[model samples]
Target: MPDAVVSGTVYDGYGREAGGGLVLEGGVLARVLPRGYSGEADVSGAFIVPGLVDVHCHGGGGASFPDDVDPRSIRKAIGAHRASGTTALLASLVSMADPLPAIRALVPFCESGELAGIHMEGPYVSPHKAGAQNPAAIRGADPEELAAWLEEGKGFVKTMTIAPEADHAMEAVRILLAHGAKPSWGHTAASGETAAQALEATSRCAAELGFEGVPQTVTHLFNAMPPIDHREPGPVREFLAAARKGRAIVETIGDGVHLAPALVEDIHEWAGANAAFVTDAMAAAGMPEGRYALGGLDVDVREGAARLAGRETIAGGCSRLSDQLALFARRGALPFGQIVRACVAVPARAASIERAKGVTLDFEPGKRPNFVVFDRGFSPVCVVRE
Candidate 1:
């Protein structure tokens, strides 16, 4: 496609939303326009930010990422995510089996542009902190099994969700980092000490084992992970300390239910661009009230909140990425730049893709083809770009 000219308030990397414009071409940014230049999107007044990204997500709408769902269903899920403003995302497959077989199954999706990558959220988590994951599938990562999954993923696995409390978790973290997969801790009940040890191992591996990233992240700061109490610091504390030292990151599910809005503001203050908001979305996102599947069980998406189909378990399900942004904008008491940082820059930093698409995301040599028009309330009025 040729370049598309967009006119509106452009939010370049979390700064005050600009009232200028930009251009998108060939699926990349092509140009950043100035005032009084109009061609494509005549967004007289609207808020335009970079496309959003979701890391730890499950099913969305009524369809779940089950073993039986065909390729068509998965594509439908991705479309639903896009409608919610997620331009790029990882297809997070909840660990049902050993995760190797599923990784092989999902390779086609990632390679074909159906997904960004895989997020193995179990098979090596703590039975106690398993959340809604089937405990029967819980087990330490055997070297043989790990090798099998990594090989099957074939570069499609972008993130690893591990149980920091699992036996030899640190060792497995090393293996994942070695395989070019960014590892984050979750689905485990690790204490402050274990999380500390995991980040410690990450630092050592980066220094001696020739790895890249350091101080592996803690997924979902409080939920699933340990909490922090001044009396005794927990895994959350460990993550805070590492981030404070510019070593680690902390990911959060910004849905008002997963975390209190007040804490969201606090995280942005401490972690800055390191605290990322993950959808942790399941299959019920963008769908009406109904039952859905995740890994191997049924879930219910009622009144826009996902819970166990029949039980009171609040196992995460599909929720829109835009809703996360809206939650912060409404409840976080933050300005435009702060909200944009969590929605754009923060996620980019976590995935190390900031230089490519966030506020500082670099454009190709030609032009910056971009778009998105929203009103004063930040609601989308129009969006059209390559």
Candidate 2:
């Protein structure tokens, strides 16, 4: 029996959009009805899509996850993203001298379901490509430190970004996989050959642990890494090649600042389902442009772009996933379905939190009612979660 119904242009998890109505019973989708079906709510002309899942996000609503130890401040950030239609997300912590305190502080949220998991974006990255990361806190890969952080997380640590060329990088990958966390490569100065070797080694480790289907990711591809030149291809080429082969997922900040629209389109065309969209947002997201903090670094947000206080390096993103989705929809550079897949499906799969948490990316029967409604302009009208 249907307790409620929402009719509109519905987008399924696999990027298929059509005019239909979703029947809800007991807080789960009971059935998907055809177009023009009478329902409790007739949201005609609105777009209905799965609740967004952001795999990489630092903070929002004036709170910095890497700097805040208070649960109130952390919840504020989570609320900000949730209001913007990101129902699932990973709280990202940047490189700091000691990450254990923050890791312990965030574990409760994970347990309480406020956050899907915690992503440590490293004290084990390259200094040259540190970008907004505090170089002083960056260190060589240490398996012991990684193990301690994972232990404190209590199975809530989802991913960690490490440079492929960092010392003991392979060991760090093994440790992350052993603890049920995925490793993402970024903030590196590794050559193409070194990047390829790292991917091969990571695949071998995952296979040994019976986790071969779970793919490693590349952190915000092309940012915090060397550019691709015809003569010197760098790691970007290797990462994209792996993505094409379905061996890895590449994250792209489609906020129109981290990457150009044309480049975003190109990568989406090349990587398809392997490309995941993320905000990489910070404390300034959903807040007015002003001063903010990411980890230990001071940042200034102006014109919707967050940057280091006095430097040109981009600190983090200010736009939410909804904002990015709107931008892509307006541009029409890629199909609307493709954009949604990158925003919702791919990221959820990358984090491997959908099935584990009973969160489905599609409006399937017996699945939790997690979705968002948007107007013609792509502004979020309402968010629903079971």
Candidate 3:
């Protein structure tokens, strides 16, 4: 096959180079030509980087993933992010009474590639830290029911978030690991001690199952989880310690609305590769400030923050992964490659898609052609998914 070359200041997922070109042949990245190399460049004048992957995204374009079983809504949600350089994403679902019905409906899309998979955020989480999740839908962990729902996705259930302090939470973690899904700790008021215990149990399970190097993650860290009270400490401290030691990965909304600018910089520096960024975006994302729906609840998006209608509680984010990238670029606190690592590389590895289809460790021959091009201002100029 003839090579299709795109040249620019290329950041090949891990490191950045001054100028280079990506070669694509047979629908894969044929090779990466370094600076001064002679290659006919077909695309230029932009920053070329790996396509962003969002492991935690609810919906966008006024389309809610957890609101309906309609495939049209699902396509709209996926399309919104794909257009913004999020070439891959998991369709996150909020807590619900019976998630199997929705999970089943989404299976075809997951298999068909419009969606990555399902991320069940609850129905089994701490009521104390439920945040925007429906309190009435929250329930104690039922391993049997969970196992049934896990199978309903037919391998599309990629990850599930559970509260360490919730009833039978450990059992839920066990079920998640046994079913080939990653279990993340979130939406909890669990003390640091309890969070540590949960980590210990998951560590033992991962070791026994030979899932090493796969660190346990905390969802949208410091948001639904307990805050750092000097005396109590809580999950923040424990999560940070594990992240620093490379035993855990922490997901930050990074939308600025969910975390402070300084804190985001600190986490990126402290956690490094263990730092994973997520959008946790909902229907309001990519839409103008207005009303939207998330998990059957009304949400109001104003000034770039999505909140529960008529309440002060923040529902989720109103930004895409591209917007988050622009947010980081504006700060200039971290290097360009580091920002891509947190937003793309780390999340892809966590989601087990780092070496999956349309992804490659290097811009080398025989790798699928998937990447993004951003203008100098950090806005997504083009996305090449071929």
Task: Show how many residue pairs clash in every candidate, following the order shown.
Answer: 23, 0, 3
For residues 1-386, write the lDDT of model 1, one tens digit per residue. Answer: 25455566677545455546666666466666765555567345456676676767776755556444577677787777777677666677766765665666667877765566777777787787777777788888666677678888886676677877787777787777778776777776777887787777778886676656543666677776656778877778888888777677778777777778788778878887677778888877787777777778777767666777688667785566677777667664767677776766666666554433212333233744333455666666554433
| Tens-digit lDDT string for candidate 3 (316-345) | 888899898889988999888899878777
177-215 per-residue lDDT for model 2 (tens digits):
998889999999999999999998999889999884555
Deviation in angstroms for 337 in model 2?
A: 1.1
Best by TM-score: 2
Q: Candidate 3 regions off by >4 Å? A: 1-3, 16-19, 36-40
Q: How close is candidate 1 to the true structure, as a TM-score?
A: 0.89
Computed on alpha carbons, the lDDT of every model, listed in order, comes to 0.68, 0.88, 0.82
Better of 1 and 2 by TM-score: 2
RMSD of each: 2.9, 1.8, 1.9
State model 3's lDDT: 0.82
Residue 109 displacement (Å), model 2: 1.2
Q: In lDDT terms, how accurate is model 1? A: 0.68
Candidate order by TM-score, highest to lowest?
2, 3, 1
